[model samples]
Structures are given as C-alpha cells and as structure tokens.
Target: MAEVEIVVAHRERATLRVGEVFLKVDADRARADAEVEAMALAPVPTPRVLWRAPPVLALAALPGTALDSTASPAAWAAAGAAARALHDAPPPPWPGPSPEEIAARLDRECAWFAADDVLPADLLTRNRRLADTALRPWTPVFTHGDLQASHVFADGDAITGVLDWSEAAPGDALSDLATLTLGREERLADVLAGYDADVDTGLIHAWWSLRCLLVVRWLVEHGFDPRPEIAVLEARR
Candidate 1:
C-alpha cells in the first residue's frame, strides 16, 4: 500500500499530499477552511484553501518546518506575531463552542469514562475541577487552539504558515499562549514581551493546566497512555 505523504499529523486531522495539492481532513476541516479564508483577509499567513467539505479541506502547499524544541527564537517570535495578528483580525461568522459548551462536552466525555469504567476516578474529578476554576474567566478571541511548536512552520526567522485549523476557534488567547509557552519558558517570555500589551502569566498558566487535563482525557478516550510529562503537568494543578 502506498502511504500518503503526511505533512502533519494531528489527533483530529491530518495534512496529506495528493499530488501538488494538500488535503486536510477530520471532523471540522470545513469550518476550519472557512475560518482560514476569513483570516486570509487579514494580514496573516494561513494556508490557502482551494476546496472545502464539512470535514475536509484542500489547500495549496507551502514550504516550511514545524517549530519544535529545536526551533530558533526567531521562529517563536514569528509565531507570536502571527498569533497576535490572527487575534486582532475581525471576528468570523463561524461560531465556536463556548467555554460553558466545552465544559458540557467535557462532562459528557467524563460520563463516557465513568460508564466504561476505564479512567481513574481522580482523573475525572480533577478534569472537572480545572475546567471550572481556570477556564471560567477570560474574553474569547480568534485563537488557534493548538498553537504549539508543532503547528507552526518556519523558513528561517519568518513563519511561513500556521497549520491545523481543526481546533481554531473564538476562545481565550491565553489558551493559545499556554500551548505556545510549553517547553521553552524563556522564549515564551520573550514572545509575550514583544506583544502589544501585557499578558497575564497567571491566566496563561491556568489555561495550560486546564488544557493539560483536557489532553489527558482525550488520550484516555483514544486508548493512549498520557505521557509522564502530561501526567505531571495535570498533577501539578
């Protein structure tokens, strides 16, 4: 079997090469495509959508690399600037699940865990606790929900494009900030310092903790072990 050359593999979506075009598919690719189209009107580097379906999108390919731990400070700065640009863009018509709605969804997922009796009891309780406490306050902005190093692409110091729009939504920018802040604290600090206004580190930390719990639940639901790093992060809360 010939495997598709995957440019990026996300939990919910994958970017695969089909000849010269790239296909993005998952449960939310259509919405993602629309969002990206809307974002393109602003001054940001998003992949150009060529076609769309509810859970699939076709985009033009761009050259770059994922901003992993080995990425340069310039890459982080580019990502930060891109994020700020997206946040500043006019709100799109595509509606995102509200925090309260997301909380409800989490509760439903927790129920699945309870019914299956697969997840530890403490895990469920902690997930709810963090969702309630940390994610409750904050204004929502257009956020790339999974803005980690892996979703960013760089050609030298410049960010060529941002990838994985599956989780793109109107949410607390802190959520995006937290994901970007992972691993490289000093670089994260520098990125924030370069932002237009002061960012609340406490809020970013809180969102990070909450997002960690959510990631754990997602892993458990999908039958993968939550790595020690994720486990430790969730426990620290």
Candidate 2:
C-alpha cells in the first residue's frame, strides 16, 4: 500500500499525498471546480489530474521539489518562463479581482490592521501609499493567482511543474510576478528576463507592499509569524 502523508490541512481544505498521487479536499466545491478547469486551461506544466469527486481532486505528483528553498537564479528564470507560458495562454472563463476590487480589499484590510494595531501606524501608512500604484487599470492576462514559491517545482535550472490551481483566474500578470518574488526581491530581474513582455517595476513594488500588508494579519491569526513579511514591507520603506 502507498504510504499516505498529510500534506496540509485547515478548516477549509486538506491535502494528502499517497506516493505518486496527491488528493486535495476542499470545503468549497467552487474552488475545486476552478482548480480542475484551470489545470485544463493552463498552457504551462501543471500536475496531471488523475481523477476527481466533489470536494476532492487527485493529481499525479510532479517530479521536482518545491522552488521555495531553491537559491539558484536560473531556477527563478525557469519559473518565470513557466509563468509567461501560462499568461500567454487563453484566459480562463472565470474572472479575477479587478483593480477596484483589489483597492477595496486593501481599504478594508488596512482598516482591520489599524483597529488591531498590527504594525506601526506610520509603517502601514507608508506601505498603503506605495500600494496605490497597483490600483490602476491593467490589461488582464491569465494568472496563477497564488504563485507562491511552494507551488512551483524545479529541478536544478529547469521548471518541472507548478501546483495548486485553486486560485487560478484572469488577473494582472504583475500580481503573479510579485507573488513569485515575494521576500526574494533580489531574483526579480532574473524572473523578468524570462518573462514575455516589458514589466512595470513600480507596479510590482506596489503589489509587493500591498500583498505583504494584506496577508500579515492573516498569517498571525493562523499562528504563523508575520515578521518576515513585515521585514519585507519595512525594507521597501
């Protein structure tokens, strides 16, 4: 029998890896549906779907390890190339958050942070001002939506595949760039080099600030320290 390992679990979802198969169980069926559809639509390498049942999805494990801990600039470039391929594909049928929606979320989350005193008021203010740059109109592209390092798999300088399509949708390409380079700002140039189009540096920086600020509180609530993200935010100031 294949050994079953608990990958991750939370109130909303859980993942179990049984040898070469990964089983994802999501409480929200819509998210599971999106994952299935997004994997089918994406042009880049995605984990092969083996089977699915409501609230659960089974995927064949990709060969490489997660890219989060890799320090190679070449690997970063490969990840960027994969991102470019995905963006170059036809847009998913579903929509992503519009600029206005993102701005609104920032506003709401900032208010919560202020009420909770999560960070120094001045730090939050500075970051919020910087975030304004990312709030403008953008040409939408197919986006990974959650392009965390853990979701990308690389073998040496080559990208094997990207995982977790649950948040996949149409959104600003910079969002994916920013997400991939989060806390690892030094690799931004390498990633951009592999990208298909000219990137707006200001928007990427703004998204970084916005993203870090928005997620800090959530990280803390989940018993994860937000210090690293906070350090990233402060460094930008």
Q: Give the number of the best model, judged by lDDT.
A: 2
**Candidate maximizing TM-score:** 2
What global local distance difference test value does model 2 have? 0.87
Please write out the lDDT profile of model 1 over residues 1-237, one tens digit for every residue.
Answer: 445797756576667887657887776646566656554654677777788765777887667777877777767777788878878866556676677876776677657657875446776576556556655756678877778777678888788987666566677777787788765566776567545567877666566556655566677656667673365454543
Model 1, residue pairs in steric clash? none
RMSD of each: 3.9, 1.5
The ten-residue window of minimal lDDT in model 2 covers: 64-73
- In model 2, what are the clashing residue pairs, if there are any? none
- Predicted candidate 2 versus true structure: per-residue lDDT over 84-137, tens digit per residue: 999888889988889888888899889987998877899889899999888888
- Assess the local accuracy of residue 210 in candidate 1 as a C-alpha lDDT between 0 and 100: 63
Sliding window of 10 residues with minimal summed lDDT for model 1: 228-237
lDDT score of residue 143 within candidate 2: 96
